[model samples]
Target: MGAIGRFTISLRLLLALTQMAAVGLGGAVHAVTQLSRTDTTYTRVLEQEAAGMVLVTRAGLHAHNDSRLLQSLFVERDMPARQRILGERDRAQRRFRDAIARAQDVLPKETAALDDIERHFETMFDSGQRIEAALLAGEDERALRMLQEERLPAFESFRRVAQTEVARLHRRMDEISEEATRKAERAWQVTLLTAVLAVLLALFLAAWLLRRTVIAPLDAVAARMRALEAGDDRAPVPGQERADEIGRMARALESFRLAAIERRRLGHEARTDALTGLLNRRALLETLETLAGGATPLLAIAIDLDHFKQANDTHGHATGDALLRAVAQRIRAALRAGDIAGRLGGDEFVVILAGTDEAAEAVAHRLRDTLNGPVEIEGRLLRLGATLGIAALPRDAGTPAGLLEAADQALIRAKRIGRGGVGRAAARAG
Candidate 1:
């Protein structure tokens, strides 16, 4: 009776929360649907009326250009010049015809404004033919009279009527915007009013559920989960010691946290070097490409262990491997959280500094000093040094491969100055 009594009280709280969420979700969906319908109406205007207007504008411009070209043809005494103008007019006619054909899509019932445009075009075209005939027959006075009386007036009428139609389309689109805006405002108001009332009712019913032990602890748990999701894997899931529902929930959340950590560990292992536990060559290249693409400043350091093969020959492979691991440890200690290091097979390693400032240069210098330090392996003191070649992104080179090549070249240049030295890429290009 006591156990049931303790849990039975939660039913009212659960019901209130569930109902509140349902109402909120429903209202939001409804509002979005209404807004979407309104937006769709506006999109229809763009798809239909605006599209038709573009065709109309283009056809009108070409027709106007054709009229000007015809006048030029009349004035041009050279046969070649007249012929060129005629060719241009022919192209203009083709373009105008194509636009009219395509514009049938937006015209009234699939023939919007096309009939009127074609009528005006035909009238002007007939007048242009008569003018052309008069000009070809060397009747200059007759051609001038035809152009003045027929072609010019027809073109004026065509432009005026087309402008009137465009003005009508503009007015229609304005009406559509006003109508949709009104509908959207009404829908948002209705949905918002309904949602607010339902949420208020839910708050009243849920007032009893907001105790410190239950609500506070649950809120803490939710916050911890959010932190964990945001990459703070160490965020603790508290309240696991409680002998209640909260404890059980805490235990479940702890399991999820553990699973997430394990998954991340596996992901790290996949990208990591098996020997040094740094990033492998493939991961290094991938990281380099990603950083190079971003806005952040970056530097690449190419490190080669000086006399590594000689060490292997003298100390055997086991000693050489141990020495490499030792160098890797020093390299890791010298890097910041944002920096990355990778082993590119035997004796070759790379480090990526996240900054371009002298602080980054300090890290490189520190790494070189540490790597140059001697090591005692199996009671034998052996010396190893690292030669470093460095390059800055978009300064020495722009691409990942180019940066790497420049770094390598710097390494070669540094090695020329003897082991344990640093070589930098060429001076920045202005």
Candidate 2:
């Protein structure tokens, strides 16, 4: 062939080989990454299922107490523990099924291994059921024998299936790796031939193209990582407009940022009290360390409804809950925005008064006046009353635990003195 024609043919062949290598490497990377994620998810689901199965089996084996046995066996039983076990079993089954479905989607070609595992799982489940029945029928020896003979064997078979599946995954990974190596070798040979041709201009063009198309985006991603570490979100990403891999990555990062913000918002909402829109006890304690700086006074007030139990017993819990909500609103209205009010639980509530030394009597009067009005619930006029116990910051206690204890003691004294009254924390008798 003519020298020009030969050179032209060689260049075309080199380009074709390079493109094939890039495509193969991209596909291999994607497949391996996807397989790893699927395996991780599958492992988690399998572990959960195994743990739940063991728990259910234990519950069935120990169903000796007649009342408990009946409660455990009956799905509609009022026993919460039994119901929880059943719920776990159902959840485990659903997860296992979902894992199987996902494996089918991701690894459709590995059907034989998946089918083996599924068949073994079914056998194990059947054996477990038979063992439970035997135990419930008072056949202790038979149940024990079945556990050893049938259940254990079935479980071992399931384990073998798991091992087989893992082996299959490893084999597939090796095959993919070998295929990638072969592609790389072929690309390298083409690259060597191109180098021998000494076409400086073409070499420079190809190198620049590779850098812009591949290396530049990778460098940008690395810079983004450093920016993220520095808590900066303003880093520019390449290929934001192009519908390529880099563009997809930029879109993913944006999604991640939005999701992170939403998660933080949700976490804050969960820790805040719904009714009073104030930080709940858990959130208050979390921030108490920061609030309780050196020499900073942290006053704690424990508030209680004098006859809350009586109110619930008489007017029903619905009315009682409404009354509590009303009391919380009144307290929030009275306290400054800097102060924290929380419903600890039930009718008992607390307020963390930062840098306050108001007397117990004064605080009690303020709260009483705030909640003095009658609350109407379901056309019934309900009169509400509250008792307060005040413990001064840095004077009565230092730590959150100490402040809570002191306030609780003061609240007990207040209840003893009068139903709807206030008391200050006093020195405890040794």
Candidate 3:
């Protein structure tokens, strides 16, 4: 064979080897990034589940204190308080069990702690029953004795165990979060290192392969970048299909871009309600604080869905969730362009209207009318309504806390009078 033929064959062989390495590196980077994301997701689920457990247990403890108060009040023949206490306890028990059930899917490391919590809860309930039996029998003395001996010890034990488990879960979550951060940093480092190696390898082979051909492939990359700058939504960078070094580089860059976008999307999801697509409690507070100095006269309207719990019980949570979304849509429609609305968890929402009481009331009435209309969900029409409480900024109160308090008081008044009624807050003292 001639010298030119041998050179051509050797060049082709080298290019083939380089292409194989590039494909292998690209696959490795993708696999590593995906594994890191999956681990992070699992950690987040554990953290959220642990937090829920803590919340429910605390709520149960609060109800236990209220039941103790009712026990004392029962001695005074306060039948109303007795009934309320029983209802509160029942709700508390349900909440505790629900939290436990939800936590059952948590990571194996948390299993033992959760099991201990469940056992403690059972013990507390057993003692609670004996106390309730004495109360029902009208033997106030026996109830008091049982409460001091059995109920107190059981509650104390449960509280201690539950709180310890909560602390452990919190620590585990912190560790997981820190580990996830490290993994993210490590993934970036690995990807960068691999890209640098690929580029160095490509440069080594550039002499054997025609320099013109090697450089020509980069035109596609430059075009991709230009498309990205022009904000083209049609596949910003198509990499991985080309067998050249430029293809590998584009693939790596695309991965980084996608990772950044995912991070931003996760941040937004954290602050937004999944059901209503509204700002959640933490985000709402931040938004309110941001408006503290903007345009002197602002109004806050606290809204609660009337009979929402009953509706959830009757029509199921799916329907109730749909109702919440429908109400959010109506509220948003009623507000002016600049107004802000947020969900404060459950069936509660708050709206910040940039106007006077008169304007706020008008908006409130429109919202009420919109919410009271029939909602069509899952082939069934349901009637839902809202009770709105309006409080004006600087007029009702100057501070955020004061504004919220005033609005809440008005909401209580609206609910007290009747469902689907609008209430205005009393003027604040200067």
Candidate 4:
């Protein structure tokens, strides 16, 4: 070809590349705008609407719980019982108020809804106080009538408003999800078109350019992101070494993954015992309190391993650990459905059963038999026996603390009486 022909061909290629660049830039700008909007909507839904909804729901539940506790006080004529219920009511109200305050902080735009929740909560709390006073004055009929007329209506109103707020939050979350989906689709379309143009332009250059540098890495990062969202944070993130925007994003996600893993580890360590993998004392007590506040029949069994220290002294710390683990396993195996077992430090363990005294006794017997396990150390056999103390809720005592106290007393009696005996707490005198 002539010099003029070569020059004209070069100019044509340059113009084509320039046009492709312009198109890609415009698509990039549009996609970025759509993604920004989607991100904002998603954050609002998660941080404000969804969090606020949960807090509101919790507040409503605690309010209803307080109402139930108050009603219990009306039936129990004993002063100590009244005081216990009163104390629980105060704790529930504190929790309810805390939840409401958190909801207000998150959903600051929902001021009117939050205000309604606060107003109704105050009304219900005040009515509860008045009814308590009526009961304290020995005016049983007046207390009952006031509870039915004043407190019940206020509680219903509080629940209604809370439910409405929850429903509104749900609707908002749904709308935001839909909007994000649409925006993401539009961005995907724009990106797809830009990719097609780049592919065509690459025909004049290297066809593999866009996929190798941009699309492939982005797809990998996005897949890893989806995995992270699905709660699988163990996978390594891609493209961290690249000195680009994608690299920055990948680095950020890796930090988040590491942080999540640390948080999970810390959470497990906090709740679980290091030796036996049973719930720790704090977690066990929290679980007990949650179950004890309800009307379900509960049984608290306190177990003390008989002659554990003797075995520990004879055999070594390793054999003692093995014995403890074997005993823990037996206790867990002996439990039925809905039963909770926890190590309360050293040779002390506790089991909370949501059943009758008969069921608890059967479990206690099974445990005493099962816990007599032999741990082999240096080809020798070492065994341990267990003693248990059983206490029933609302029969031995009403509250969680009282139940534990009764169970502990029974355990002390069991220890004094025999080597491996089961002792039951005496029924409460109403």
Lowest lDDT 10-mer window, candidate 4?
A: 1-10
Residue-by-residue lDDT tens digits, candidate 3, 1-430: 0112122233344335546566456644573555445454744554464445444344445435444444443433435546766786677677667667666554455677777777877877787788788778887788788888887777778778877876676676567556555555565455546555554566656555644454344555567667656654356465457644345446544543553454455567656766689887667667777787777687889998887787778998678778888888888888888888988767888998786767888888888888888888888887768898988777788787678778888999988999899998986766
Q: Model 1, residue 412: what's the lDDT?
A: 97
**Residue-by-residue lDDT tens digits, candidate 2, 1-430:** 0111122223344354445444334433343344334334433343333333332222222221111222233222223444555555555555555566556555656567666766776686676677656655667678678877887777667766665565555555445445444444454454454443433435666566556665566567657756766766655544457554345445545543443454455566556765456676667677666777757577788888876788778987667768877788888888775777877666778887665465444555788677666777788877767777888656777677678778878889998988777778996444
Q: Where does model 2 exceed 4 Å of error?
A: 1-242, 258-277, 359-364, 376-381, 428-430
lDDT of each: 0.73, 0.58, 0.66, 0.75
Could you arrange the candidates by lDDT from highest to lowest? Answer: 4, 1, 3, 2
Error of 3 at 297 (Å): 2.1
- Which residue runs does candidate 1 get wrong by more than 4 Å? 1-232, 239-245, 293-298, 313-317, 332-340, 353-370, 413-430
Candidate 3 ranges with C-alpha deviation above 4 Å: 1-235
Between candidates 3 and 4, which one is better according to TM-score?
A: 4
lDDT of 4 by residue, 126-195 (tens): 9999998998899989999998899999988988988788898878867765665665557656655555
Screening candidate 1 with a backbone cut-off below 3 angstroms (N, C-alpha, C), the clashing residue pairs are: 107-112, 108-112
Which is the winner by lDDT between candidate 2 and candidate 3?
3
lDDT of 1 at 399: 84
Candidate 1 TM-score, C-alpha based: 0.42
Q: For each predicted model, how many residue pairs clash, with residues at least 3 apart or on different chains? A: 2, 0, 0, 0
Q: Which stretches of candidate 4 lie over 4 Å from their true place?
A: 1-216, 219-235, 238-244
lDDT of 4 at 333: 90
Q: Which candidate ranks first by TM-score, i.e. highest?
A: 4
